[model samples]
Target: MAGCGFDDLPLTRPGPPLNAWGLYGEGDEYGRLNLITAQTVQAGLREAKEGITINLNLPLDTMPLNPTRAPLRHEIIHRTHCNDDHVSFNTQGSTQWDGFRHYPYLNYPEKQQYIYYGGMTSDEARDRSNHRCGIQNYAKKPISGRAHLLDIASFLERHQRSPLSYFDASTPIDLETLESCAAESRVVFKPGDILIVRTGWTEAFFGISEEERQSLPHRQKRGSCGVSSDPEVLRWHWENGIAAVASDAVAYEAYPSVNSPSIHETFLAGWGMPIGELFDLRELAAECKRLKRWTFFFTSMPLYVNGGIASPPNAQAVL
Candidate 1:
């Protein structure tokens, strides 16, 4: 658990996780992503034993949009006698990756402290001329690497644990729980690895009738579950050389944070880590159980929109 070597970057200096701003060099859009080296991708390629591919995306618009926000307005126009069509929908209406621009470093204590990675301010983002940290940087060259699937839900089920209710606000999967599951899976992690965790919340959410599911907004809550705001969890990730982390949960961190400096502050803001959420893992987890292996070659393609903040990851796992 030395440092991320961010201090070694040309424009960066030593700072305990706070100054990764210039780690990959000032104006660096691909922060921790730089960890995905040639060796990392090669290792992922080596894991494609049978070339079996699994798609990991939930159907878009499966539930009506939250009434507070406009519903996903989708429309398809067909050309007469030409067998052609055009369609449009929100990029984040389904599975997605929260990009570098999605969050800012809120831990800055100064009253006028408005800064982001590389010490850039929100004003920088306003200038459409320079969308430096936009998610498009990853899209221009999609993500491909080893994916470690930590099936937290199934692990709990096999042990006959009590039911985990996502709507209950306090159920959180912390580092120790994650380690227990990883050890059970017998999978070893490597640097630059893309991690995926399944909480079973998505399945339960989708199983309810559409009417019941949509009623979530009325209750002023959504049935969600995620990793706890445990510093140890973040430390473990950096120390293990994880490139990015994703989950089959809504926020990827518990809905109601139990502590300050939530994972979002340090991860997305501090280390420039990528966070993917709401991915469908029921099928992939089943495959991992059947094959007795949890590692696979993971690939994801976000829409190649210029300067976009976030986008759906048409993610897939090849085992």
Candidate 2:
């Protein structure tokens, strides 16, 4: 069939790829749901063989204070915990999806695309009972695929430099900067792979003096980086066909939008791809850099809470 009268057919064709990214596919345009099992997911973790679990557990202790811009008071009910026993569980914080509901696109400042598949509405998407892109999808089974870690820290280190020791509130991640980092790291990216960035910014804030750290421009806004976000950089990530993105930086992207626009529009709203903000990728990045290898058995399991807006994943980078 390949050589036979294929030339007779029109040059143009309309169809999805053998492995397309969106909700549907070619043969089964309305893709079938893949039920991930606990055993299968465990197998993925075992394949990683690192025996290391990067705790993506949300700092419940700090969460309550985050809303008030102060430390959490012990008197307040700890929503994420159940009991005082260290091992004894009392009550657990109701994990959320941090759905498109969690953030707004700074640039367009509009709602994420309301995609309805199989007669579902955008409002319904948030309904946990409906299971529309619930966090469960992230953990019902292991996410098995190619993963690439872009070591922003190593990239700068190779050039005898580094990102600021602290969030500068002025640092911005642009396309050129990302490309330059990739070139230095000698990393070649592939489509549909998870893209991870290592900024090393979160580390600086962890133990810094509250006054100096809080005074930083980005922190003054939201305890984020000093650099602003850029649209072109996001366009690059989307154009490259990245399935998802994770960053070591606290805010994933920059803090304040220099151009008054953020890439969240392009990646989250426009593409419907998820973002793993506040990922702890230091060791992972360091390991890849030292090994001079990138491909790995990557997996992350997000909490399976219904109607959840965000999830604290058990994200892992295994080689």
Candidate 3:
């Protein structure tokens, strides 16, 4: 069980489909993150030959992309000569890492029974004192590893001569496209590597006017381009030893879920893998193309909120 492959899934008896519940150990809080060992850290450090650092977080003041989430609020407190500011907003309102408790698998659709990672029930996740699989676990260790950029949009335009209809279109970036992009970039996958993909979503969002941006949430039939949530995609990720995945898309998977048991359910709830969404990858992509190097040292530290479901990805990449 300690060295199981993708074929040896459902480590728990009578577990959810494609689950690796006990792969790390019973009640393991750090799911696939367990792959980031000292050796992996050393390997990641080797990628930082150049001293170029790129910020991967969108501005905290960026307009709320999700309609359900409230816009960021900031209030300046006047303290004579010194001014203090109080800010509050949803953790997932911008670039964020979806923790194990953020998305749960529906164990019984009829009864709407949902379960978090390590078999944590909704009640356990909601308990104020319980922190079984909270984002704090990640905050304690943080996430650092060698990351490879796929630049899917660039690949499609260059290779297939097919540009995406729109960043908000319901386009699916399949496994073949991913593998092909990696091959072209000469990025060799390694265990504990963080996969960062650029779908031009964030770049396109910035291209629109503020009025249009304000109306994004009100649009009808709006869809975002992202990686396909097909079973093979999950298998490929597990087989390739990807520790985590991030994208510029809203959900990190095609919105509205084209498949049963969406990637969010399997990756976050079943496998305990973090899903980073809305990461500002435009500058990173440009730098990677300029340097002709897609691999870089990536690091991220989430907020230390006990029993929190998600947090802003205070992430950066060094090349």
Q: What TM-score, to 2 decimals, does candidate 1 have?
A: 0.89
Instruction: Write down the TM-score of every candidate.
Output: 0.89, 0.64, 0.96
Ten contiguous residues with the weakest lDDT in model 3: 160-169
Model 2 bad stretches (over 4 Å): 1-98, 104-131, 140-142, 168-170, 210-220, 226-231, 259-261
Candidate 3 accuracy as lDDT = 0.87
Candidate 1 per-residue lDDT over residues 1-319, each given as its tens digit: 2254433322344322344666566567787888887888989999999999999988766453345533455565667755554445565556888877666666565525545555557777555677777878778767789889999899889989765677656578878888999999887888789989899878888788877777876765553578887767766776688888899887788866676566666677667788887889989998999999999999988887676767789999999
Best by TM-score: 3
What tens-digit string does per-residue lDDT give for candidate 2 at 48-92? 555443443345443321333333234433547553433211112
Writing each residue's lDDT as its tens digit, candidate 3 over 23-97 gives: 887779999999898999889999998889999999888887778988789999999899999999999988999
Lowest summed lDDT window (length 10), candidate 1: 7-16
- Candidates sorted by TM-score, descending order? 3, 1, 2
The CA lDDT at 125 in model 3 is 85
Q: lDDT of model 1 at residue 71? A: 48
Winner on lDDT between 1 and 3 is: 3
Stretch of 10 with least lDDT, candidate 2: 10-19
